[model samples]
Target: MFSIPLVILVPSAYGRMLLRLANTVKERSDIHLQIFAAGNDWPLEKVKEMTEAGIYKGFKPFEQLKSDFQQADAFLTVMSFEKAEEPFMKTSFTTKWLDYVPYGKPVFVWAPDYSTAYQFAHQHRAGIAVSEDDPVALVKAMIDAASNLETWQAACGGARKAAETVLNAEKIHTLFVDRVNHVCRQSQDTPNIDDLKELAR
Candidate 1:
């Protein structure tokens, strides 16, 4: 059985989605999804239910989580399709992306088309992106990723390139400095204090 580890935070918002995917995969494939619930938001009842059902693998500390990642075949992350989350999901990137990329393991993203997760996967080709909310589609994506070594290798290579280029700290710092300098240059022609006081009056 291929073990795919997922570290999920804020279970109140994402727990159901993860359950749906896990149940579907359980019914359809030999994939074993080991869910490590992080944060304090997970309700005890839900955790108990999933734990008994063999879906929830309990929480791991940072060191243990890193060890699990090293042992796992791949990684998974998701964005909720709930309408209330759309605005935030569209603009925000998951930190899990950063966490998984460094491992060079296949990162499977199940998210809506508008989500940053999907966009990042599409942009960098760093992971498999299943834009649809269908569990079957997500299952197919996972199966494809597991079966095709060349595809995942290429994706991992793209992830490496992204880490080396756009995600590089030095490059980002340079960009920030350049932008600040441009803004300072533009502000050079701004009105003096007396002109500002007159305008306020």
Candidate 2:
């Protein structure tokens, strides 16, 4: 379906408002909403504390990563990939956006100015995004996103098509074969390698 699925990729009590906002988007826009993270990136000591306080939603392991990616028509990453700029960015300097790129999902990042993934997605027709840190802006972006599922799906499809090339098993297999060939060539180059081995024996 062209209708976008809204998936929150961050895990925190601070994210509750976003979760509440997702309910609104679902009612108003027909988008599905869920929660996810690559793993319990949050500290283990805080797990029970967060869940007990109703601050945590759920966690997905690397094995289940593919399903989690598929569950969302869109992914939200709250980190920044920009560094030189300070005031607009504050602290984060990483791309949470990369985690979802393999799924080829549309990404919505509350990111700093230099988000290469956001810019790339914008250029590739993967999804729409917003700047500024206002939570209201996030909700509005969600509303706009609610209707752009068709566009989001197209981008995701393209992303999935390219995932295999980047996660190439055969290319990895070729590397393994090349290593064996290199070792064989080295053995052949060694003069009296077996003779020396026999003398030692």
TM-score of each: 0.79, 0.48
lDDT of 1 by residue, 104-145 (tens): 778888899999989988887877888888878888887887
Off by over 4 Å in 2: 1-33, 37-55, 80-99, 157-201
Residue-level lDDT of model 2, residues 38-156, one tens digit each, is 33445565555445533344655656666656666666655432343444345333344445667666666654445544455455544455665565676677666556767556756
- lDDT per model vs. reference: 0.79, 0.53
Every candidate's CA RMSD = 3.4, 8.5
Which residue ranges in model 1 land beyond 4 Å of their true spot?
27-29, 39-46, 52-54, 169-195, 198-201
Q: Which RMSD does model 2 reach against the true structure?
A: 8.5
Candidate 1: 10-residue stretch with minimal lDDT = 38-47
